[model samples]
Target: MGRFITVEPGINIFVEDINPAGRKTIFFIHGWPLNHNQFEYQYDVLPAMGYRCVSMDWRGYGNSDKPITGYGFDRLADDLRIVVGALQLKDFTLAGHSTGGAIAIRYMARHQGFGVNKLVLIDAAAPSSVDKQTANEFITATLNDRPNMLHNLTNMFFFQLITGPFANWFMQMGLQAAGYATAAIMATLRDENVYSELQKIVVPTLIVHGVHDKIVPFAKGQETSKLIKGSQLVPFQYSGHGPFWEERERFNQLLIQFVG
Candidate 1:
């Protein structure tokens, strides 16, 4: 069972156990508009393998307190710092997906003073990819008319595993939980430039991306891996955006091997 922990004044985070007393901790940060529940697959499987896994809901998502403030990378990094401090975690690995990957990179750049051992970025967005006029245009089109694009994006994530009734319910649940304000914050995410910051990250890092991911795209992952000094890029041939869900077993094995 998972428990709620208060990391900030109004933020209550959800944490699931995966070997509470294990030596090494794996702190998983979920993407935008989705909560810790997105990591349910990881939470259930990692613990039995003698690894401690922790996933927290960002402030406005999941069961966390939905404050209208503090939605940027710095603030999100602070939230994560508080959670780590409150838990007194050290020598841990950080794994993030999509927006969470951006946040994790920021956190490592800012807090390398603390002891973060390794990092894992799954289908992550690059810092300057938006600067390319074409990419920026695509982002603008998707954000401007998300409703029309949502179904296709959702389908791309699961490779059409979710469709019809199940897909509708899933999208509805995500929207209802995140709401418009969360979406607005996500829109502002493009402003962050992580390329400059990546040079400072000295931890051993792994970049995982699906070859067919339409959301962040595979090129971003390749570029990110190149930027992060000694980082390794792992490609998922048959998976799309949400490789963690589509290729759960392989993903978990890679995670264990990297963190081990």
Candidate 2:
């Protein structure tokens, strides 16, 4: 159910479309330095509940084409626009995690939320959560020692105990991405501000953030919720940056209730 879609000339994004016959669709965009496969648990359960689960690996990550340039949020959002149009999606729920959530916000502002009816931001990196200094440190660390940076990031991803092997596997997802692209995206996270974009969102939004999240502080989610009128904020007390996996059951159930 996965295919390479040509979003632009010389660039093909890897898209995974599951349970195509389902009544409703939830399109997922993953966080930074990881691909669509990051939502493995959700993909396993949603399709069985009569929901079509669609996910795509943005360029320079996972199975997608890794180009040298075009890592800006504007261009990334544009890529999403094309893919949605190609799939003929309408009124689908758009779910984005971390950096993907920021890009999704940009898409809402830039494309006017073209095919999306609802928005879900999970541990999103927005509302000026990541400061410039920290982002610069990350970019420097990534350029200097990429493996160690990813290793440490994996350790900070979840509050629950994750096995050593599992941590390695998760870190590998970051390794799969291009080094320059990873840095470029981090730069976008550092330089770009999404507060105005968040205010422009008109669809019903669900903001799910881990109360103990180290990557994106819970206060940022609060700020994002305030900016987007009528957006609901849900805090996962036991999780860290990745509530979708750390608290998969509740996360999936919340998605079901909101998307329904």
Candidate 3:
């Protein structure tokens, strides 16, 4: 079960601690349009491996308060700093997925005090201009009707493989529980350039990507791995954008080794 703590006014972050005695703290940041619950597999398994695992819903994405102003990478990084300070987390590992990866890089670049020792980027978007022409083509092709495209784009993270009544129920619950401020903030995040900040990170890093990922692609991960000194890249053969979800066991083992 997760415990709730107020990280800011009108915003309480939900966290679950599996083992307090663990030497290091692992903070998992979820990607866009998904809540902390997306990391349920990690939350369930990592604690037994002797690591204190903590995952929080980003502002507007999970149970946290979603305000219109707190969606940009800068604000999200600040919020992460606040939460780390609140918990007095030190010598911790920061792992982010997609947009969450961008936010983590920004936090490491700007904050000078936190002892973030390791970083893991899962199919993350690098801080470069996503081929504007390609983005436009994708938007045009996928969204024949702009209005309908908007709705689909909003829920693009959820895979169609998850079907039946449960999928419907899950989507309803996720949409209702997520904050409107999240959507507004997400719009601003789509404009961020995180590639420039990569060199500023001095910590040991790991870049994991799905070879078959259609969203972010393998080249982004390869480029990101090259930019960060001493960072290792792990590819999930049959996975797509969400390698952690698609290859949970392998992902967990790799993370454990990296954390050690």
Candidate of highest TM-score:
2
Q: Rate the local accuracy (lDDT) of all candidates.
A: 0.76, 0.92, 0.73
Q: Lowest summed-lDDT stretch of 10 residues in model 3?
A: 141-150
After superposing candidate 1, which stretches have Cα over 4 Å from the reference? Answer: 129-150, 163-169
Q: After superposition, how far is residue 40 of candidate 1 from its true place, in Å?
A: 1.7
**Which candidate, 1 or 3, would have the higher TM-score against the true structure?**
1
Cα lDDT of model 2 by residue, 66-108, tens digit: 9998888899999999889888999999999999999899999
lDDT of 3 by residue, 116-208 (tens): 988999888775634556555534533354334334543443333545464454454356334444344445455666888898888989999
TM-score, ranked from best to worst: 2, 1, 3
lDDT of 1: 0.76
Off by over 4 Å in 3: 4-8, 129-179
Report how far residue 226 has shifted in candidate 3, in Å. Answer: 1.3
Candidate 2 vs. true structure, TM-score:
0.98
Q: Please, what's the RMSD in Å of model 3? A: 3.8
Candidate 2, pairs of clashing residues: none
